[model samples]
Target: MIEKIEDIKRIELSQFKFPVNVYLIDDLLIDTGFPRTAKKLLSYLKNKKINKIVNTHGHMDHTGGNSLLQGYFRCRIYHYPAKRSYTVVEKLLFGNLKNFTSETPPEKINTDNYSFEILYTPGHSDDHITLFEKKKRYIFSGDLVLHGEAREVSRDVKIYRAIESLKKLRTLRPEKIFPGHGEIFYGYEVLDEKIGYLEDLGERILRLYEGGKSVKEIVKIVFGGERFPYFFIKGYFSCENLVRSYIKDPKSL
Candidate 1:
């Protein structure tokens, strides 16, 4: 279903195992929907007169439809510089992010009604960036504030960097935040909630470690032994991933 948030339009979907929320701002499309939702994505853009695409990050679910949409509209796909080489990215399972040949995007982009400033907000991914509209204080925050908790994540995500990223966003005072997934709404409160969740996770991990609980035991105690709900990506995101972040820096608490 499509949701109207103030002046922004949101295309929300759930069949892809992970929730998908793609935003449309005039001719600027923010984060293409997943592969499974490409057809619906095209239909949505059919009458909307899309001219450009701005990917929040290089994550598969976020960038999968870039090629499809680009093929349809002959539009340009813009994102941060690829950390991995093109050949290296091609070898990966989903190299769709390499489809972009956009030069380094400008610091600020001017549209018919608003100007967007690209802010590099890493943590979810090294190349992650957010689009901020200064006049109205709106933030197209990628995956930074997915939910009220940073409970599940990829194993390699850094503990301190994620926290710092959210803290940095707080300083911007973004009145509205349009994330890559879930609903679009206000910002500061969610940042506070997710940051607090991460802090609590660290403290609990410290206490559990002192009580002589192993990593696996700590996972069970914290997340009830639950892996991800999907089978194929079962272990990719789980309580163990967050625990690993905590174990990497118990002193961070």
Candidate 2:
């Protein structure tokens, strides 16, 4: 349930697909696990002295347990300070997501002894933010930097914005990445790798678009051949959504 990464602790339920990656470093709590793992998360938080809850983004899984945690700890919460809205496709696939809000945090999040800089990194979602610790070169990146290539995170994600966010993160030259889904990355060129992934995907999108392929056709040509969860649907969780995102922000090309 809880694992050690130096002084920070990672709490995950490990029950279903892509569980939330919540981290506790000193007095800061970055992202909360889903509702299914709330009990375990509460157990871990009960013994700790957390003063602030900083959410990397407003995704449901990352913020599901916020009310419960806030009810228990009654600490200040931080996020990208944006209103929430759902796309027609997302509503059809996963209905009724809650809106989350938090005051824009100050430049420096000064805890008892440690501090971090809050960065607004939008792409996967509009309200995404990444926390960077300057002294240690550590970044708490939410879904902004997942393990692999970015695609169809939601129908609303912006491919260009994601690329821009990655570029901004790469500027920080972080030594380690604490992501939202997978294990922690240590001493690796994590940001550059993600940037390269998006660059390559953008190239593929442009090549397909130049060939006069529709978004649906592009999806099929790019990722439709891979079989796993049937991806025939047009709007909901299909590569077509990714194609549309790339089309909107083709500057990445």
lDDT of 2 by residue, 1-253 (tens): 5779778888875545656689988888888767556667888789888778888887667766666777777777786673455455444443344443456777889766567998888888778888899898888888888876655556658878888988898888889889988888875487778788888988988888988998767877788632335543344454666777887745653
lDDT of 2: 0.75
Rate residue 69 of model 1 by lDDT: 88
On TM-score, the leading prediction is 2
Question: Compared with the true structure, what per-residue lDDT tens digits does model 1 show for residues 50-121?
Answer: 777888887766776777788888887788863323333222433344354554457876667778999888
Off by over 4 Å in 1: 83-103, 229-232, 250-253
State the TM-score for model 2.
0.87
Error of 2 at 175 (Å): 0.7
Clashes of 2: 0
In order, the Cα lDDT scores of the candidates are 0.75, 0.75
10 residues in a row with least lDDT, candidate 1? 82-91
Which residue pairs in model 2 clash with each other? Answer: none
Q: Looking at candidate 2, what is the lDDT of residue 87?
A: 59
TM-score of each: 0.86, 0.87
Q: Locate the minimum summed-lDDT window of 10 residues in model 2.
A: 225-234
